[model samples]
Target: LDRLFARHEALRSVFVAPQAKPRVEILPPDAGLPVSEHDLRQRADTEAALSDLCHEEERTPFDLARGPLIRGRLVRMSDEEHVFLLTQHHIISDGWSMGVLVRELGSLYRAFVAGQDDPLPPLAVQYPDYAAWQRQWLSGERLQKQAQYWREALSGVPSMLALPTDRARPAQQSFAGASVPVVIDVDLTRDLKRRSRQHGTTLFMTVLAAWAAVLSRLSGQNDLVIGVPSANRGRREIEELIGFFVNTLALRVDLSGEPSVSELLERTRRTTLAAQEHQDLPFEQVVEIVRPPRALDHTPLFQVMLAWENHAGPSFDLPGLSVEAADGLDQVK
Candidate 1:
């Protein structure tokens, strides 16, 4: 516990600053920034944003003690357009915390553009608070129940995911991959929502089931495994807080054709609810619970991802400000 906190700033900080949102003043997009000058390609825009954010803030002795930790950046891309990109360490921000970060950034940006003060609320809690709560909750009899379910559910399941990889396994550990992109149309997306409503399950569960069916068809295997990021935000106090309150959970789904979509959803619904109920347990602990041998060549217990959508968070407005998804931002990879 001390080691993990020592490595992550948000873990040590009692709370995130209410007004810590990063800001960039963009004159216009017409004035092009030379790629050579910045020494960055279009693809490296996100990297530059992260680097800029790290050093932009005043680094105090306390911050130095926290190590080089900064998770956000605002870059002026052009006269009219300024793009902000942030890469928070997994220790600080989880998938759920992305929404919280974006909303606050948006609110702060809009206020800055309008020459108004940002009335951002102070964080009621921090990632450490959530972590402490989780450690206390996921113990003794409660964890035993979770252990029983996991053991039964995963019994006899092979550890390998059988994903196509490029090179043979080397002694040193490293991971690399390229993915094929896929997109779901707006109308079909709406149909998915309707189907989810009909099943009395959430959109998350419904989408996850559809992916399981796809994997079943592709792999020609009855047994399926997927990794889902749990938001871990059921608690009211931490909903508005940022950082890695998110953790990935390995959810094994059976697509042997015994259960229809609705039935499968029901199973998933129960599993998801049960998982959420115990979500305070970090993925680090889960790795211990489900001890499948770790490997370099082979993918872990679960390889496929069943992502629903990106969190847009709140929006910021300049005099002529507007936000739109970049031409290919939503392209699924």
Candidate 2:
């Protein structure tokens, strides 16, 4: 809480003339932090309470946190197991921030259990600090040259993946996507590793190539557009700091002929290298500067996304928790 909004002056800057600064505040001691241990229909109920919570404060957009933006009620089914119902205002949190928040919550909870009131050191910097650096650092001749390469490489490229959709796209360009994972069996995985070693390409490059091939076949388009998220935090200070510190790199492939997996992989490697070399630019900026034709029928760039993430560590000693994979929520592209 101390270092979180520290860097983003917008976070700390007040929306009201009366108040000087915005801040993250802990609820007073003996505050009954209501918790829901089960999947309960408490969003409406809790939000009503938080709405009242907001009314008590000044009429300021920034007083939202103290309201109910990130509402996580404690769910204490038993002494050993207590979970939280975490909800956030999309304005302050993104997919990346959710992961970071959960991890930090776990750390803080563990520290409280160990009788430590305050837990964790101040981060060397925060997202705002990095944002400032990015605005200043990503400029000059080097940035321009790399951008020139991107412009030439992406010129005249179609922006959509042509995935078959059930209904015609809406005027608003709303999209819903799902992904499915087909894990290789033990024997198949072993053989795949042996072949990967022979080809001298890492497992990720091979998998990305195969996925690209599959998409090319499904879409019936000779060209494939895939977006991969790259962690843009190269500096040590912001490595652990949390925010939307990621950039999307568009991976394009021209599958004119039925290229072998090896050939596809070589192209994929070249494409990835080019992306990484100039990935410092953010997607929003790219769109603004490139001035792609604004069309309701087209996405600004890239269609499909491929991602690999590691969230769990050492995978042990978690208790009183039930984890289930629901097919409805797990959608595949």
lDDT of 1 by residue, 84-194 (tens): 443333545566655555555566666677788755765666556666777788889987877766656666666755544465556655654557987889999899899
* Model 1 weakest lDDT span, ten residues long: 31-40
Candidate 2 lDDT over 210-257, as tens digits, reads 888888888898787788888776777765655556778777776778
- Candidate 2 clash pair list: 35-74, 37-75, 178-331, 178-332, 179-331, 179-332, 180-332
Clashes of each: 12, 7
The TM-score values for the models, in the order shown, are 0.67, 0.70
Model 1, stretches more than 4 Å misplaced?
1-66, 71-85, 109-118, 163-174, 257-263, 319-333
User: lDDT values of the candidates?
Assistant: 0.59, 0.59
What are the runs in model 2 whose C-alpha is more than 4 Å off? 1-69, 75-83, 89-100, 117-119, 164-167, 176-181, 310-333
